[model samples]
Target: MDFFTAQEQARRQTGRLVVLLVLAVLALIAVTTLVVAVVLYMAGIGGAHSQPQPTLQGMMALLSWELLASVAVGVVALVGLGGLFKRRQLRRGGKAVAEALGGREINLNTRDSDERRILNVVEEMAIASGTPVPSVYVLEEEGINAFAAGYQPGDAVIGMTRGAIRQLSRDELQGVVAHEFSHILHGDMRLNIRLVSLLHGILLIGLAGGMLLRSLRFRRMGGNKRDNSAALVMGLGAALMLIGYAGTFFGNLMKSAVSRQREYLADAAAVQYTRNPQGIGGALVKIGANAKGSALAAPQTAEFSHLLFSQGIKQGFSRFMATHPPLKTRIQRVMPGWDGQFVALKPAPGVTVEPDQSPQSTAGAGGRASVRDNVRASLENAGAPHAGSMATVLSAASVQMAIGAMGQPDQRHVAQAQTVLSALPAALKTAAHEPYTARALIYAMLLSENDAQRQHQLAVLENIALPDVFTELHTLMADVARLDVQLRLPLIELTLPALTSLTIEQAQHFRLCMERLIHSDGHVSLFEWTLYQLLLSHLSEHHGGAENLTLQACERECQRLLSVLAAAGLEQGLESVQERASEMAHALHAAQQVLPFELAAVEDADDMQALSLAVERLRRLKPLQKSLLLQSMARCIEHDGRIRPAEAELFRAIADMLGCPVPPLLGGGTEEQAVLAE
Candidate 1:
């Protein structure tokens, strides 16, 4: 259940994939060389004015080292280039994959009840897990399947079939979404995308051969010379076609080898996440009973077969080649000791299952002592440095709860997320779903409290923003100004899908206006910086593969990040500069004890620019290393035993940038109490 461990496993899986690709390529080259050698020997013997090479030694002579080497080179070049081409095409991330399969993004403002329900479910899960809300797409098919696709969490999107929204009840839909989210959390999407690209390379030879065969229809072959030439081309094309398909057959085996086990893991994860086995178990049963089942009619389904929730295409000839386990087996695994009966697909009202009253379910639904309160009380008891006392602010249980929530949020977190969503003002929530008002909502969030600064920001936006957007900002300013501070981050999370829907021109204009507004104040506050970084990171196109950096190599970046967290944690009303410096030293010391290396002295000029650069650099750290860094950060921020609202926000932002999702830490307190405690 450790997030970083899952990510490391995925990295290892990539290495295995590469080895398989290499083997497949070598096999293709060998087959292709043999085919070429036979063609050459036959042509030599059939020549009209040349001596015939009909002997075994003469045929061996045609299969020279040079000829074999040339074929090898040609095969390698074709496969390598084909894979690179496909990988580049998918560089736009999951959206490109979804769109290529004919998925239309569900509009955030859609009034359809099913679309709205799915969006709400997605938003709750995202907020609970501390990741950005992913855009949702619906394929125009009636198969009960879903997929989560992206290179990373920032660009991830969830795709569902039409049948899934219509056929599955609310709990069943939640289960399906949870399964896809598991793929997003465990790094399966990137691996799936790479598989697609590699398979395309293996199949390229077949594509070329088919094209060659089809071109013969336009050519005139009346002359003897032309006839021979046509025959040679036809033979070579046929050989390549056969060889390429054979390579693809092995590639499919590789896909099954890699993906089949992961599907089981995802199903188990879905059950664990929702604390209700019947949710996902029922979904599988429906898929088994339905006529369309999980099969897709799209022609590109073969390429993305391994990415779906179930077998996306019909398995022919060999069950071993299926990317998913059989339906009955998967259901039994999730729901053991049950009679094996497929749920009949009836056109009745949606079933409403009562909530489970088991102890585990009750605890997940907030029946036990709150972890957030425990951490807060511990911090409160530790006291500030200036108060002439301090104690251990993080208890074992509190630390476990905090770290355990990352990429593996339990039902409690989901329940709390639902609470947060319900608390939002209706108008503000509605505004967050449309591109125009979403932009305005963000603009309003950045408006300054001081009269002069607020006027300046407003003027800047008025001159630069689109007229309708500017007007919307004016209308939403009152509600945004009154928004609870604890809800700000969640609200920002909600805006991502809508913001991402903006046209290229509109997005460019929005970014420009935001920059102007932030700089118009002459300085960026912590909240402003966090908002800008979070939005830009998700909104920009993500390209390139992951970079591998050890903690040792990123020591300087690590130091800067820790230093910023330390500075952010200092209480504002310290009586003297010496007191402030003393608190900072104590925070650093706390972090140093947890980290493996010695802490470096941080300069007083730890501005937002320096912190931003440091975060960007540290993002490349290996997954486990990132886990350690996050722990050290938590230790540093908790040194004084209390977390201010701003400090908690900064910590969450840092974790999000590093690809870690920390559940909300300010839960279970009244809005006034939470604000006043800071």
Candidate 2:
């Protein structure tokens, strides 16, 4: 869960993902080969049969031509289909990412207090781990299922069913969240999504041609009169359809193989993240014993079989299409004595929440809490001495415990959020649009890992919402955390409610994230952090936070990073990795927000001179970073707190030259910092 380990996990996950991509490409190639062979074989047979009066040599030659034509058409059709599916995936996935996060699903209007409580937990985990809080949504279905989805952490999302909300204990729920979070941090989510897109690309070929067969059937029956190229068209259509199908079977095999490994890793990571295999193990067992043991009936479930918490549908072999390992085997790994029966750990009526003693929670019935505390304490003691690294995440038990506990925090995070909500005095409703109330809520959501990170996030908070209210609320970080003056959420939440209003400035408020993290240890560990900040700020200023280019650019950037994190697969799933995931995801999400702008800026530049001028201008903008060129671009553009499409295009070109994937701008596609009043 330390910095280096997270990076290493990312590297490993990325490596595996790259391999999957290679295999997907190979699968497509194999399909193409098969389709061509099939079409050629069939065409040769048909041609040989048609020439009743021909000699053997003439028949052979005619058959060869027929086969060649069929193969040619088939190959083209297959490749075209491959490209089409890739585009479709990117487009669909891109749209899904946008709506999954900054969309209305996570908006204020949709969340009730209970749902908000869960969201509050997610936010706290992200802040603690330093990841972008994956957007969350609720499923009205009565099923007890949950899932994490996204091409990468930055674009990741978590959704829970109503059954999950009402049924599971807080700790058990934590176990579930931790498990899903594990998938996000270890890059399984990206791989899972890739599986979907790759499979789609492979199958679409056959599916496309299959549809065409119907059209060809009509032509064969003389339903049409056009004679030119009729044979050629028919041959082409048949070949393409045949080829498309040949690609599909191999693609499914590849998907199953890659998906299985990731699932095992995710299982281990879930144990590792929670530090209590029993939590996840127990959850799995409960699923089996409960009437609805991961049984999914939705038609769309098959498309996402590998992404579910448990097997939604019972597939043959119970292993091969079953996205997860058998529940019994998983349980044995974590709890040797587990009886395969659900242990009844019901809380007393009013004890829905854990008792407020974390130090004691460490030693309570649930073994996960104490182990997590020990790990955090160990890391904290390592302090400035032991720079957190991938190597630090060891101990079969501790890792598992850490992983499990990671899903749920010690309740303080939730309590704090609750306090923020409760503190809003009745009077605060009168000034519904005050800047400070929004700022206070933002801080409640934002509170970070270390002092420096919190402070840096605070700086980004500057001029964001009710600057004055935030100014007053900012003083509390010292009181609650640094000084431990009060432990109640009410005190923290009550900061400005009676006196001010809450409102959203825009999502671009995160432009300063890289700077905050870069300065985490009182200094930037990597110079890239500064440049990242500069890039976001400049882009946000020129393009509104809602700009498509900005959002696209950031997504692209996070995807590249996800490619990196793909290397990770800890014993824990999303548990403690929460901090690392959230921090990076948020940073990456910021970049995603500005991607569209970056892409246009890169592809549309007319010449090196224009690109250079734009780069130079961007360079001189406020907040210089180690990336000299990035700084230069900032300098070039911020002359008037604006960047026109012309300038945005120029910025895009420079980013390309620098070899950076454009991230979609955070928020929406609008230019950064709209002048809307509270």
Candidate 3:
């Protein structure tokens, strides 16, 4: 299934989960009400003059509507309150989840080779997939396990056990990381968080029963008067415990049904992402061969068993309760020809691993020939351009491929990402890994092309930024100016982990400095606006909940986005105003053809502030609705014969806002590159 279909399926699964939760709650209420009725009847509290009979009819008579209603209300309130409390506690997103699991966030500047290798793998995947690079956490455990957790990509984190990093090879580590990325892309993280919250409520019933039983230990039953009351309390507590545990038993069954299939899907996705079945298959084999296996040492493993890469806890007495498929089964699915033998893992001695270099050719020469034919076909379908417009044909194909690769980047994208990362300067890469210089690197990117405006922004930064950071900005300014325009976003992505390391006060100050620098020249270029929005979306304190917007609800926002994109596509060097207007009209017409309704041109079509507002509103579009809107935007960009750097950047920014990860359109030098080179 494609990313959108997977996301829709996840939503359906969540609905099913809610239904199961309701059934379980109803069962708990019924059981609790019966227990309460029995307690009252035995204690002779049903009525003062009532003659208690030892019969089923007497029990039925005692279960009055008033009594049943009161018990049901109490049970519902307890479960509801417990769920709300857990959700509130986890409001900080995946970081909170990680911290609760005894994970320590890995520093971006860590010197440990194992930590560095995992960090590199994660960065490559993030760039290839066009999502924000997630925060990495390390659990000091010897088990080969990992998990991805968060409500959305913006606040997501990837956690790994020490053994997983130390024992797995680079390819194996990449496989595991890709498996987690699938969870993020397929909307599994949000569903997993919801499971954690809802299950906590069901577990609360058992906890309440246990607490009641323990409290009865200190009470003294002096005479027969107190003996009846003691016996009644003991019976009620025992019944509550039985019912609560029964509810828990059903909840685990529900979790197992929901989680097992997704594990298989994630394994397949990992192989698809790396085009290396052996990578993931080998990891599974090692897990089986190792004595510890993938079992976690953490006490909270049972709570997050479904989130782990492998089963982190043992299934007691029943395969039906296992959240993951058996190890051999998972291995065979990834590698169908597996001999069903587990490979024993040994510690690597004096081994140093480096990031894989980009291949000289991607896939093979046949792939390039196929791409050419596809581009030619696209040009013909869109009405042939002039003979010298090969660049236009190539750009068209890139945009189409980008749309196709959303949330499912293949090996080609990974190689392209490696090439980009390799092209970055060593010094700048180092700066991107440290918080102090990372801020300066971002500020340097925002400096204006005009010498006076650049100096003005520098002046603003010098006053508000840390003295050391301002100095670092001056030192990096020359290199930043010379950097390729296409590399700008990837560079910003690299800084995310380091930036996240800053204290709250420090982050706030950094954001303030960025705003001053962007508006220092009285204008926000498209690049500046895109950079600002990307940073703001990822770094913000609050992560927005799931959205269910339809196309009709976001009609105005859709038009605004298309209008801005259509205007962005017009070549600035067009010989005449009429030529520019003609291009804009063509772009708009192309958009209208894809859209269900007519799109009217707005007067301030290129207004950054207005575009920002439109983007915020459109971010709430449903996954399928977003797919349609993106196709319209792509149509507008392709209407023009050629794709400019500015236009590609704007398109990427919009896609990022809509939660679609489009790989970088890597090719050809731009005018900005030429100017920077000079």
Candidate 4:
């Protein structure tokens, strides 16, 4: 499915979920009212004093309208409260989900070869997909399962089972990660989270019922309570239990209905993305052949079964409760006409140690080389253009089309990613691998070519950063300073996952330090502002709040950002600024035919503050608006028919800020080399 369609589907699914939840709530309220009335009648609340007996008709008469209303209200509150609580608990995004499943975050600096290999595959995929590399975690389960979880691209995390890491080859692993990426790209994570939380809420009634029943078993009924009272309490407990299970039954039906088809789409997308059916299909075949069969051993797997690349938990009800399609059916979809037989696979022999391939190795079947062959794959991938297959000028009629092109994963991207990954500097690549070195590497990029500015920035760092980090900064300064204009942003992109590992306080301090350094020379270059904006926008989780603004609502912000683009493009001494501005205006006008407006003239600002504010506001724009914004930005930059280094950097920074990790323009290799040489 395309990006906008997927987004629309997610919205529709949410609506369906709400309707289902409401129906379930109503059903629960009705059942609870009946149970309450039955218990009360049995307890003799409706019996005559002389008769000492309650008939069914008498009980029906005793069930007041007020009682039913009260029960309905209570039921709604319980379900609503449970959902809200669970949502809050999961609000931390994919990391929380991973942690709940007993996943351990992979340290960037780990020497373990398998961990390093996993990081390589994830990095390549992120670069290929034009997204920030997500945090990766490893679950200790022996099942061959994996998942991607997050509310958005930035907070997303990729999780793998110990079994997945051990059993799947490099190619198979890529395919599985691609499958999870499909979920991430298609906006399935948020809906999945909602489903899990809402299902939990529905199950809360059952849990409460079970608790009451368990309590009744322990509480003695002999002291002061009449037989009917004890029996009524038991009946109430029994009724609650029944109602709770009923809620679960309905919730499972909804979950299955919502989840099963998406699994099929994701599987298809995975094969399409890698252009290698064997990768994902092989993984599935292994799952079937193995005893564990892609089943997660974690207790929490049942909650997020829909998010997994394969079924994470066993479904008791074949077609009704299964979050994913049957393994054989899924395998056949990817690899058609497969006999219903499992393949017996084994680990590669003598692959006990880390591969030692130089940074330049891009050769393998489908760019799937063993770990021993491509130690620098991660960095090289970062250096390459993200979407080299498409011409630098992305073609789109609307914002969604533009974003769809940006977000879609393709086989061409894999080749270009490998090419880019192979060309990175060894030292720069090494620095991006470890947490401490990664920070220093970024500082090195910020350090000026001017000796005075460089020293001033270093002094700010020394005062704010720890002594060790400062020392590392000094050590890596020479290598970082040697980096050319084109490679700088890619290096920063490489550092993002490690930077994300920083504490909130550390991130804040890092943000502050960066601001002081950028302004230290008494001026902010466009490149500096762009770089700072990209770093700070992503590094700070709540950078611009939500992207909830309609295109009409964010008109001013869009104009301001467009003005910045116009100014940046014109700054390169292009002959006619007006002509370029006219071209930009035309692009904006064409892209946003729905909201026709001319480009507002650039308003001067004393500092980069205007551009920063423009970006902050632009973050609030909806996806379609962002598409128009990107198209307009690209038009402004490409008016000269060539993307210069400064323009390319600005473009990348803008894309990253908008949560689109645009690959390096001009497709790396000789083109980038020529720019660096210039």
- TM-score order of candidates, top first: 3, 1, 4, 2
- Candidate 1 positional error at 167, Å: 0.9
Report how far off residue 395 is in candidate 1 (Å): 8.4
lDDT of 4: 0.71
Give per-residue CA lDDT, model 2, range 1-678, as digits (tens): 422243245445556655665565555554444444443333444333333353545433433445555654654455446656654555434225333322234332223544644554454444323234455666554456677876544445677665565655444555677667767665566666766665665566666666666676566555454332345446645655665555555555555665666566656655543344555665666666566656655566666767767665676753564566777776777668887666543321222221111111222245545554454444334421321111122122221222233323223323222222222332331122233343343343345655676676667655454466566565544433332111122222222221111112333343343334344445432113323432333232121111012223233332332222221211234567576455434333333332333321132222323333333333222111212223333333332233333233233333422322221111111121111000
Writing each residue's lDDT as its tens digit, candidate 3 over 2-65 gives 7777777887888888998998898888888888887767766656223545566666777878
69-160: candidate 1 lDDT, tens digit per residue: 99888888889999999988887788888998889999887767777767777887888778899999999898888888888888889999
Worst 10 residues of 3 by lDDT: 384-393
Q: Estimate each model's TM-score.
A: 0.89, 0.53, 0.90, 0.86
Could you tell me the TM-score of candidate 4? Answer: 0.86
Model 2: lowest-lDDT 10 consecutive positions: 669-678
Candidate 3 residue spans exceeding 4 A from truth? 48-53, 224-227, 349-394, 666-678
Tell me the tens digit of each residue's lDDT in model 4 across 635-674: 6555545555666667767877875555444343443333
Using lDDT, rank the candidates from best to worst.
3, 1, 4, 2
Clashes of each: 1, 134, 0, 7
Better of 2 and 4 by TM-score: 4
Model 4 ranges off by over 4 Å? 46-54, 225-229, 349-404, 521-523, 543-548, 574-595, 605-613, 661-678
Model 2 bad stretches (over 4 Å): 1-114, 216-246, 342-678
Better of 2 and 3 by TM-score: 3
